[model samples]
Target: MTAEVDAYLSALPDDQRAALSDLRARLQILLPDHHEVMSYAMPGFRQPGPKGKMVVGYAAFARHLGLYPHSGTVIPLIDCAPFKTSKSGVLFTPDRPLPDALLSQIIATRQAELAAGYGKR
Candidate 1:
């Protein structure tokens, strides 16, 4: 993980820190070729190379935590039923962390989008 991301997670509450750290570990394993980055002030992974797009991002909030797929359409394509979802992200909590299978689906969908050259600026 990047130092910036480490600092960010270190500053969060114990529960939030633990949850995100777990999520971060899962992401790292899933995206071994991606680069860890602090984008939009949140911790996330980006595709390799200098101009690679952001694959996914995550953040902590007062009442909940969020996993951002960085695309307006990604969340809709996946099953995020129990957790609250928006156009760009899924709202979850430390008490009820996102399921491992669901997180895998999210990463897969985002990677597919990147491969297709979607969500490009």
Candidate 2:
């Protein structure tokens, strides 16, 4: 996490703070090699995909903690669609628990999107 991201997360209230933390951990496990950075003033991770690199970002809004896959990889898939996340990324409301299964599917689809972009691999 970048200093900016760190400070930003540190400032969140306890509830949002915990939810964002969980998101950060899961994203890290999903893309361990992703380079962490701050993008558009938000914490972001860039991971290599099949086609190119994929970027995931995070933010704790007043009502939700956003996990941005950035890429459109998971959009068309059904399992991940429940979380939808609009045209942006997944959203977890404060006090609402994070869904591990949904996060896993999102990560997997994002990776596959990158991989498929490269080739049949």
Candidate 3:
């Protein structure tokens, strides 16, 4: 994990930290080749290489934690029912973290978008 990300997580409350840390661990496994980064003030993983696109990101909020796909289109493509969702992220509490399958789907969708040259700046 990057120092920026470490510090970000370190500053959160225990429950939020634990929840995000667990999610981070799962992401590390899913995107083994991706590099950890802090983008848009949130911690997330980006594809490897200097120009690698951001694949996924997440953060802790006052009332919940959010998973950001880095692309506004990604969250809408997935089934985020039973949880709160915005155009670019999904929110859940530490008590009810996102399921493994759903997280995987979120990552997959974002990766696909990156591969297709969406979100290029």
Residue-level lDDT of model 1, residues 9-90, one tens digit each, is 9999999999999999999999999999999999999999989899899999999999998899999998899899999999
Which candidate number has the best lDDT?
1
lDDT of 3: 0.92
Provide the RMSD of all predictions against the true structure, rounded to 1 decimal.
Answer: 1.0, 3.7, 1.0
Q: In model 2, where do residues sit more than 4 Å from their true spots?
A: 48-52, 80-84, 118-121
lDDT of all the models against the reference? Answer: 0.94, 0.70, 0.92
Ranking by TM-score: 1, 3, 2
Candidate 1 deviant stretches above 4 angstroms: none
Candidate 2: minimum summed lDDT over ten consecutive residues — where?
A: 75-84
Per-residue lDDT of model 2, residues 31-82, tens digit only: 7877777777788787654444645788877766787777654645635444
Please estimate how well model 1 matches the true structure, expressed as its whole-model Cα lDDT: 0.94
Give the Cα-based TM-score of candidate 1 against the true structure: 0.96
Native RMSD of candidate 1 (Å): 1.0
